[model samples]
Target chain A: MSDNITKGKMIKPENLVYTKSRVMTDNVTSYCPGCGHGTAHRIIAEVIEEMDIQSEIIGVAPVGCSVLMYDFLDLDIQQAAHGRAPAVATAIKRLMPEKFVFTYQDDGDLAAIGTAETIHACNRGENIMIVFINNGIYGMTGGQMAPTTLEGMKSSTSPYGRDVATMGNPLKMTDIVATLPGTYYVTRQSVQKPANVRKTKKAIRKALEYQKLNRGTCFIEIVSNCPSGWKMTPVESNKWMEDTMFPYYPLGDFKVPEED
Target chain B: MERELRLMKGNEAIAEAAIRAGADGYFGYPITPQSEVLEYLTMEKPHERTGMIILQAESEVAAINMVYGGAACGKKVMTSSSSPGISLKQEGITYIAGAELPCLIVNVVRGGPGLGTIQPAQSDYFQATKGGGHGDYKLIVLAPASVQEMADFVELAFDLAFKYRNPAMILSDGAIGQMMEKVWLKPQKERSREFPEWATTGKTPDRERNIITSLNLDPNKQEDFNHKLQAKYREIEKNEVLYEEFQCDDAEYLFVAYGTSARVCQKAIELAREEGIKVGLLRPITLFPFPTVIISRLADQVKGILTVEMSAGQMVEDVRLAVNGKIPVEHWGRMGGIVPTPEEAVENLKSKIIGG
Candidate 1:
């Protein structure tokens, strides 16, 4: 087998490796270079295409940069008010139970202004998916400190670093939502490397597949990187995130329905 | 079959009419006076009858956003709340208006300013007629003085909301919301078979995906959209100004009122006539358009206009603007949930207008 293989050679047409997801348009993403939102969008679009759910899915885009998710994703999308995607998704899923509804929200939109909606939706077990991108800072509004910003982290709003006593501790919202009985699947993942990206894609597919079970809410939080907001190069931000953010916001499944 | 008549509270009538009008969803929170609306919907279980979604939202803010969601999908959706609750919903309402999404909002107002009282008040008139939330926008406001109008306005509100692709509000008060009266419920109308092409229902390949949003970052584009909305509002004002004239023929004095105050003013007008004041009532059914043309015409015929309200002179400002200084315009109101009686209104008119 080794002798028959040629190194650094182009494969045959039938052996073509990877291609863009059909559900994703050719339009370039609005996300900055090296930002994790683009990878997250690709993961979702790929999952929607692989699952053949492009036609039956409606996405709720948040007020942050991902508000234009419809531009890149071919699925029908509704733009929700800041932090109101869960409430919007609840209605979309309820009114059309057969449709696959999901909300793409940021840490600021999901854990800060929308905390009530996020918690209540999970508590009610709305049969919809919520994709939360936690970048530890608000990127769209120019590096403002988010609720998920780690203690001692410096951002535009927290120029003197986050004072845990005064600014409050970093909110572990995934842990909180996982505790809600209405949630069927709750997991935290990241996409900093090729291996992590593959894992995140699998998690998204699992969430979409869980929708067929008519289970309760499925929440997937991606601990993403915002290089510009963090005042670091893409490589430096990933290294810093791996060294700092992963310890506080560890990546793993917090809750999942037991196998029968 | 003959239409069945049943005694229902104004809040209950709203819930029943929403179901009968083929509303797709009711998202609401429990508040004083208007809690009956949510309670009735939950208890009646319209989901079984017509597959209408009834969700008791965590807060008024969430309820209105849910309505925004359903409406964006081209579903006839509604939410009901009292004054304080409606205040919480203003953010979502503004978003819905900016998106031009069609939905119905019922505000059964109580004494406000700040949790003033749970009693009936028309203080929300300014908030409703003018834009309640931040934006250049208008909500088609319908004032239902009777339980029948409460029932009837459900369909009308949905119709007008979809007609203009704008939010419509039923500005009721605590008195009408809690009071029981006979209402002839309309038969269940079928939901429209033709969905809006702009709705964000899951995209089919035949058309492009729809986006419901209010985010126009470019100032110039936002300004142009604002101008377009103002033109739509102008058309609405031209076409949808509704009012009823009660004994306006040859009357020397006119009473301007709406909602519960309109009912009270009707009685006051009768008493004023008996006392030889030659008074009539101009009850505005659509408060947003303000019935300005009718009030302008009546201003020419009447010597003076006395506007009665349950608030501290809110609608009176609109009445004066409509009068355009052609005649004397005065405001008489009992604030903080103090509903003036017919005798008090008549006495106020006599002392304030006739004596002056």
Candidate 2:
């Protein structure tokens, strides 16, 4: 039976394969099962290749699971300290305005520790892209509560569900960022289904395109999943994302500028 | 062609000089008297079709880091602030120095122990010459007296920064930054110097990955890094010592000063000369490679050397070290933004020269 499975074709539960390849390799990701980061990475890599701006692109990796993204992506990568990716990317884009620069940040890194850098970078109208991953919990640091964690979501730190009176409410970063005129593009997308993944790929592509055109600041928030931290299986996590997360954090573009 | 100069403030001169020097970018935060630098840049349309980038950063820390990023890519970048702001930029300054990136940093120094008065002071003399940041490093510190030198030294600072691939500083004071004079701006020249291919401007086919980092984990490798930096310092000291002398031919007393103090000392020397006392001034332009040999030679001919400054005797230490007790070296200064008048400096010089 094992021989039969090997002879024909066997798609493993943990393995993911994409059609188009850019600089990112086909190695199995270090993310846990049902992790949405792998999907987001694949979409960004595909968009980079599609735009054909790989050579002139620079990516800043923030501290978290994505800290070692330099190894995965074959672009000029700079590692920024926790929550400092926006500040670093601001410098890179300002210096080499012709280069397509972006940062991949986690919720804990952006909303919690690096709030000032993110807000100011957007306010300054830095012509760079930000791919913010909001997984509701700190996946790399043993599943701690994050700034974007839902009010009732329990984690290692908040073993008794996230009490808003004590831990504060979930931060709406996309809505906040949309208020800034410097922000040219702001959107929130998910990766629970293939249709949503396709839409997310388009959103990511649009942000990269805006950067290429040197329009202004572009931001995309990905409401990602962490099955390991959520204490659910891969299938159940996907179901939970649709049932629980979508209602609170509706997915769609929050701001799209009209050409004058 | 030599042109007549108009009077201008030192900070205003810096702004005009940066424009005339074809500086590609200016990232600065406003502080005290140095606000004129930012104000001038904002008023001037330097970035219109000239490819110049001017930004007012959120803080001094952000401004210097922005300069580091721009300089890393081979752009002519600069930033200016006062003492407190300069303190916030030490981390980024150390990184730029460690990477051997070329950039200019201007410090319009003010009194400071902790949020001290915004008045003029030379309290940052030790911080400027002796590495302001952590680790082993040195900035080419240029002290300018007149508004002309303030304008002239900006161009010179850029030259030295690019030549040595290190951060260069123009250390001035509030009197120089705020006082107005006439200045004739010179024509800007296109920089033709080529940077090493190792600068992180992205990879060409010929070179390996160019990493601009200060991290060294291994002890042996760190030692080698230190040795290389020392060699660079020695080369700089040999080639970059700059100073000016006034009426030292047959003088009995020598007045050692720099920056704003030098200007006051020059007036004092004239007054002393009228009083039948042969007094001369030796003003150092480059404070880091402190004009040691010149002071040593002057010590042989002079009876005593009086070091005058706006702060409590910082450069006097260097003067004593240079003279090495051969001649009695004395110092007098006013702290907390008070400029020592020519009368005060002349009186102090008279006491040191005659009373001794």
**lDDT agreement with native, every candidate:** 0.91, 0.84
Docking class of 1: medium
What TM-score does the predicted chain A of each candidate obtain versus native chain A?
A: 0.95, 0.91
TM-score of the first chain of model 2: 0.91
Tens-digit lDDT track of model 2 for B184-269:
77776554345456554543335443445455557899889888988888888889999999999988999999999999999998
**lDDT string, candidate 1, B1-356, tens digits:** 13569999999999999999999999999999799999999999998888899999999999999999999999999999999999999999999999999999999999988888999998998899899999789999999999999999999999999999999999999999999999999887766656788988787888877878898878999999999999999999999999999999979988888888889999998888887889999999999877998899999998988899998898889888888899988889888877789999998888777776
Q: Individual DockQ of the candidates?
A: 0.80, 0.23
The TM-score that candidate 1 achieves is 0.97
lDDT of 2 by residue, A161-257 (tens): 9999999999988889999988999999998799999999999888888887888889999998889999999889878877888888889889986
